[model samples]
Structures are given as C-alpha cells and as structure tokens.
Target: MYSLATGFRIPVLQYGLSPTESLLTKINGGALAAAIAAAALSPPPAAWPFGVVGAGAALLNAAPGPRSIARWGAVGYRRLREHTAPASMTAARGETVTWELYPDHGTMQNPAKRASFHAAVDQALRFVSDQARTAGIQVHVTHHAITGDYTTHTQTVSVHIPKGLVASPARVLETLEDEFAGLGALMRVEPEPIPTVTEQGSGWVALDDDRYASTARITGWPPRDDGTLIRKFLLGDERPPRDAARDVVPERSMAVLYRPLTQRRSRWLTRIQEAANGAFTTDPIEKEKIAIESDGRHDAMVAGEVLVDVDAYITVWGHNPDSVSAARWTMTRLADRHRIRLDWLAGQQHRAHVMTSAHAVSTRKGSVL
Candidate 1:
C-alpha cells in the first residue's frame, strides 16, 4: 500500500521525497484502510462515533477518495522534507557553481606588469569562453577590480559553470587552469570548493574541511567618488594605526562580490534630486548620507556610467579554536575601522571556501554578459 501511495505521490511531488516515509505509508495504509472499512460495516459500539471517525479520516486524507489519507500523508511528508533540506542541497540545485581564480604573483602593482597581467587575464577569459561555448557548456565570467597599493593586489576572477554540461565543479576548474596554461598566463589558479555540511551543531552546521574558519557577511559602505576605503581594504593595505599588543594578523582572505550599475535617465534624476535634498538637510548623519549618494551619483553621471553593488567578506583562519577566536577579533576590528559591518557566516569553517562561495552564491551574483 505504501508503495502504491508513494507511486501516486511521486508523479505529483516536484522536488524530492524520502524513502523512509514512503515505506511507512505503504505499510500503514493497508491496515488503516481495512480498520476504517471494518469499523464502518460492523455494528456500532455504544461508545464509538462512526461519523466522527469517518470525518477524521477524511480530514487526515485531505484529498478526495478512499486512498486520500495515504496520498495526503506523502504530500505532507514531502513538504516537511523540503523545509528541513540541507543548505548545500539547495545551493547545488542550480545550473552553475562559482569558482574563484587567483594568480601566483604577490602584487601586480607595477603599471607595465599590471597591464601585461590584465591582458593575459583577458586573453585567457576569452579563450575559455569560446572553448566552453564550442563544447556547449554555458559560462559567465566576472572581472574583479584589482587595487594598486603597498599590498598584494591578487587577481580575482569569478567563473560560473552550468552543472548540466559539466559533470562536477572540479571539472570546470580544471578546464580554466588548462586554458590559462595554454594562454601562457603563468599564474597558479585555485578553485573554491562547494560548501558542504560536514558536521551538524546545535543551531548551525560546519562547512568545508577546515572546521576553524571565522567568517562574516559584510554590509559595505555606500558608494563614494573616492572609493579608496574599499579599494585599500581589498589591496590588503594594513596602514591603519593599531594596538600592537592587541592587534595581530592571521591567515586571512577577503572577497568583494560586486556588479557595475548602468545609467537610466529616470532613476538617475531621482537620485540626483534626493542628494540635493540631502545636501540641504540640517542633520549631520543625513548630510553624510547625501554626501555618499551625491558622490556616487556624480561619479556615475560622468560620461553616464554605472554604479556597483559590492558585497564584501573577510575570513580569518587559525590552526585551533583559540587561534581562530583571536583572528576573528582582529578581523572584526579592522572591519570596524573601514566603516563596514560584519555578520558572521556562522558555522562556515574555511576562509578560502567562504571567499569563493561569496563569488557565486547569489541571484544574479555575477554579470551574466
């Protein structure tokens, strides 16, 4: 009976269903149906309410017909399964996965070298795109801005791969590496792994192999004409005054997931007008908001450019719980200095993994074109 119930429900359930419940439904449905039918036909027990039992069974079924209870039970179970599904499973259902590409060189600050490096990156991207298309694998590449400062301006590129065409996320990465090698882009590339549920805790779960990552989701400061705050942060500029006794640098990684904004006449006009009012407002905080918006608006207005939505994350890694705890404190302090807010990715274990996950874990997270 459970098999029959599951067979009936499988065609209707769009997502996935559990085998345990299906088996239980098959076992119980026959017995329940028989009991109900037998009760209805038997002489009424003085204390038993036949109408109530029939109505209760009907309500339990929720659907029409004799087998409604069994079918409805399967439907209910499916709903529960979806709500309790693992976050990783939800993420994997997508057509594509995001991978982060990095270069071997420490800082590409020299103009001639930077330009050469960028050129190679462009050539490699174009080559990969063309190759993926020929192979019928759809992909989109996002070019991240590399900051020039007294720090390592690591080249970061986000690659999106359709899971259907590619058997695994690792394959997409292998293809990129091969393309880069072919183009003579002598940089070493590392692909981020998919966040997997390695362990379940009280209220959260661990991700990736390293169970010691201190992660956070940063709400970035508004757009400004001089966006050096974010630029410097990404460039790994560590010039901020710190208490040497308390502040310490640890194994860390940062990711900035952003998209450029395009000019739209109506929206542009509205923002400009808002900034104008903001300029006139007496409140200091309001004025600051206006300044940020105005600067961004003015910057965008120049030659009619686009704005960018930047989502930044900083991860600190350690060898043990104590080290992770200390590194997280330092990372948080640095974030505070930059006027950015950090909300921990909670249960995320690897800084590198979190950084890569940021690249592709959003709806329209990357520029499709």
Candidate 2:
C-alpha cells in the first residue's frame, strides 16, 4: 500500500481500524487478555488518537523530523512571497500586508493519488480562513509539499499570509510554525512537516447551490456498516454531490461529509438550542437534532461509500446575491434572539461577497447554514 513521491518509502495504510482478525484469533483462543498485555507492552499507538479512520489518517501524516516541517514552510513562503511581495509604493501609502499560515497533514501519502490530497488541502485551507475571518484577519493561503528521501508519497502544507503579515520569510515561518503547532497539538496531530503544498488536480469551484464542480475532495454519508465507510475518505472517483446541479441541494453543504461537527454547525445548533431555552437539549430538542443529521436519502448512498466525521468550510457560488437576503435575515434574527454576535464573511458586502469569521462557520450556501 506504499507509493512514491520524492523517492521515499511511505508506510501506506487505509483508514479505519487495522486488521483485527489476528487479534480476534487470540480472543477465540481465550488468550485475548494476554494479547492486550502484549500490546500494552508494545507501547500506546503513537502520540495521536483519533476515532477509527481519522486516527489512522492522522498517524500517516506524522512528521519524521524538523527538516521536513521546514520544507513545507519554505513552499508556503515561496508562494506567499510571490503572490504578495510588498510594492515599493505600498510603503508610502501607510499600508501593511499580513500573511497567515495553516498547516495540514495526512499519513497515507498517495503518489498516484491526486484527488484526495487536493481535497485535503482545500478543506484545511477553508478551516483556517474560517477561523481567521472570525478573528478579524484578512488572509490568503499558498500551498506546499514536502518529501523524504525514500518516501513515495508527498506531504502537504499550506501557508496563509495576511498579505504582508511579516517582513521576512524567516519571521513568517517562525510565527506560522508557532500557531500551527498549537493547532496540530489541539487536534492531537503532529506539527505540519512544512513543505511545498502542490495541488495535483483541477481544483474545485462551487458552481451553484445545487451543484459544485471541479472539486477535488467531497465527503458523503451512507448509513452502512460495511467498509465502504472508510473507502470514500481514501479512494474514489470523487463524484459530484447529489442535487448539486438541480434547484434543491439534496445534501446539506454545511455538514462536513466524513467528519463530525463540533464547532461550526454544532455551534450554530447550540445557539439555536440556547435561544430556544434548551428546547434542543430536551426531549423535543433531541428529536429536532435527529431530524437534521438524518436529512438524506433513505436508500444506500451508493455502494462502497465511506462516511467519516469532518468539519469543513462550505462555499456556494454563482447564486443571486439579492436572494440571500432571506437567509441573511434568518441568521441575523437568530443571532439577535440568542444574543450571539454572528459576523458576515469578508470579501462580501450587501450579500454580494460574504466570508467567514472566527466565531462562526463560513458557508456559501446561506439557506443550508
């Protein structure tokens, strides 16, 4: 299951629990306790812990050394430097350029695997933008990819700069490393092995509410107990979202496909719950919650589909800005009622170009939000 990127050996493993048949045999032989003893004796599985597949992918993306992290950072700096080199005229105008960096990693590297990596970087970039906007920072990201001598897979890194946030590459890397390190630890992950984050696919562009095309990675949910749950995360044709091109979006854009929601959607739901005076937390609320999560088809969501919990930034494009008024009203009214300060997305004004912020999730589809 290994692949090549920079001529290094990448230990390839898919998402979800590793094979248990060997352990199962021990259990059947009435030696399960001994096996557990052996594992406990072997060492806890790495420094990171994730639920099933998430944990596996996280582990695969672990950093091997500081040199690796620096490589990715270098890649990000290159793009940022190129995209937003301070113009000599910018100085006299009393303008400041700021740059922000966000780092992401996945263990299972794919040499031939193009789509998933691009999607991974996209998801990570949006997550960073969503956080920064909420914190009142203007940011643009440049990607990076890093490699080891014998590894066949590429390690990805993306740096977001606030258009001249720092005066020098060294300073930028220093500041970004500190911030992303904290995020990685908070997420129970290794610090990004900063490298050139190269995107290998055509990339994604949200066409409209009903359809999102040119997207690299997409998450889907199919209520199946089979292994298809993990396959979608690691491998697939990268299908278009159902109802993406139609009048109605069949799937909820705000909901992270394979990942669960803890902040963005979950936070919104919490506010609604609180504003409703714990209505969502109580008996009636539980039912309401169930209704939203289960908002999908009744039949199988395509065979061999994988379902994992993810948190992402959902964008809707090419919609009539005027029509978003209803959605804006709904959100604002909810905010007022709950006393929650909801912010609009940047690069958007008068419903024309809304971006995200630190406290709220950024979504292109307001109706879904």
Candidate 3:
C-alpha cells in the first residue's frame, strides 16, 4: 500500500512471523533433520547421535511443548512488534485523534492584551483537562507557536486509540466531541490515518499525515533570577504563545516535555556535577566536603542551581516538498528565539509523531471507538 502522507510503500508480510509460527517452524525443521539422520545410520551403535537428536526433537514436539520458549519469545517480541507490525493489522493502529483549540480574538501586542490572551488559553486547557478526567481519559495537551509564510499558534490535545478498543476511528473522535461540547474556544478534531512504513534506522513507523517534524534538546536556559529571559522562553517577549490567535494554527503542533529537578539530592548532585565539569575532575562529593570545611558553606546548601531538562518537538503539515521546507525553516527560527539548542530527530520523526500525539489517554474508553 502507498501512504498518502509520506509517499512511502508499505510492504506485504511486514510482520514476518508470530510466536506460534516461529516455534512450529523450528520444531518441524528439527524433527525432519533428526528423522533423516536416524534413517541414514549404518548400525545400531552408530545411531547414538541420531538418538540424541530424536530426544531433542521429542522435547520440542511433546504435547503442550514449546510453551516455555513461546512465552519468552512473546516477551522479547513485544519490543520489536511496534517496528515490525502493520498499522491495519490492528483495528485503528497508528490512527490519531487531535483537537485543535483556538481563541476567539485577534492579534494583540499590548502587554495587557497579551495577558488576557494567555488567561483565555489557560482556562481552555484547564477545562479540557477537567473534561477528560471526568470521562476517564488522560490526554496530553501541547501548545505551538508557528510563524513565517504560514502562521498558526494554538494548543492541541491529541489521543491515540488502540485497535482492541475501537472498531472505527470516527467513533473515537465522536466520543471526544461529546466530552468537549460547550467549550468556548473554536475547536476541531481530526481523525488522521498514519502511513505505516519501514525506514532504515527507524524500523517500522507511522508517518504523520502530510507532516514533518523536528525535535530540539534544550541545552541551556536563562538563570534563575532572569525573569526576562525566562518569560521570553516560555512566552516569547514580543511573540507570546498565542500572539497569532487570529491566524489559523496550521494542522501543525509542537510539544515541550519539561522535567525539573526539585528534590534536594537531585538538585545538589546536578549542581556539583556542573561545577566539577566546568572546572576540575575532582570528585563532586569531595569538593562539597572541602567547600563546607573551608568556607563553612555547603555546596548542596546553596540555592543557585535550578535545572530543567526540556525536550521540544515541532510538527508541521505540508502537502509538498517546498511547503515542508518552509515549515521546517519557520520552526527553526521560532526555536532560536527562545535560546533552545536543538537536534532534528529526522530518523524517528514518524514514530515520534504518532506516539506523541497523546494516544496514551484513549485506552480509557474501552470499545467506544
């Protein structure tokens, strides 16, 4: 099958064999070889080797045999299944249901006006989260700021439904619509069928529907006391997260996963490591002791280091190569403004796009789709 999204060809027999098939093949082949060897034996004493082979074959062919091997294979195969399986093998595999949220108003540059825009966005996210929780769904919501030739800034809530639960993709979307009824913001939910393909290095993956993605690993951020830089990073100084509310948010999205070090032990260790790496190879534990003994100030006691590991991913929907190139350029520029150093994850873009669509939440509505 040819994928409308990525223009990649899907191969037949994508998943070569299942647990039962593999085990049976091994057992049958082993039995055949043992039978041939036994038949070829010149004399009874020469049949010892053949006897051992027959014994091994008996173990594999025994009633309820190969069960142990099959169990182990299943466990190991789960990890490989995602990369080897076809999307259609499961009811709605690799399908995505996304909700795009847009505010009612237009672009506003004034600080006060921007504040109002943010407030509206915050309320919308809260409302959606509350609704999902009530309906027993755990959704992942992300906000994006897209600019350049095509401008769009909006928050998107995505859910991925498993095949076992849902028979049709539209039904899953309808459930979400029911939950999102009466939410003030203009919202649209899209049922997207991802293109499944096997790519070098990435293995099997579902390409985002007519979209390309890039990921950035945030290497550094503004200091703790620098509110200006922090604000700009979170809500760009001139270009707030919702600055382009009036402009359509392209069928594009960006997700920022932030992990902040809050525990005392973790924070101290990170600070010590950073200090040690910046200066000498002296053990951080030893350096802490020396600083405490000499200066009467414990390195861990200092409140200077507040580290957050941020991973940001941007997805852009474009119909052709030229448009895709433009979308990538716009995302690159937007990322630079926040001082976020990034490495494009081109190899895993398709998989990342599917999983990060927040499909983890759709499992709650069993059989609803």
Best by TM-score: 1
Residue 159 alpha-carbon offset, candidate 3, angstroms: 7.8
Location of the lowest summed lDDT over 10 successive residues in candidate 3: 1-10
Candidate lDDT scores, in order, read: 0.45, 0.29, 0.42
TM-score of each: 0.45, 0.23, 0.38
**Which 10-residue window of candidate 2 scores lowest in summed lDDT?**
1-10
Residue-level error in angstroms, candidate 1, position 290: 2.3
Top candidate on lDDT is 1
Model 1: how far is 26 from its true place, Å? 42
Clashing pairs in 3: 160-359
lDDT of 1: 0.45
Cα lDDT tens digits for candidate 2, 289-357: 655643431121222122222322322222233333333444344334333333232212212111111
Candidate 2 off by > 4 Å:
1-155, 161-175, 178-213, 216-232, 235-269, 276-369
In TM-score terms, candidate 1 sits at 0.45
- Number of the candidate with higher TM-score, 1 or 2: 1
What stretches of model 3 exceed 4 Å from their correct place? Answer: 1-99, 104-139, 143-154, 158-191, 195-212, 216-220, 224-252, 257-311, 316-330, 355-369
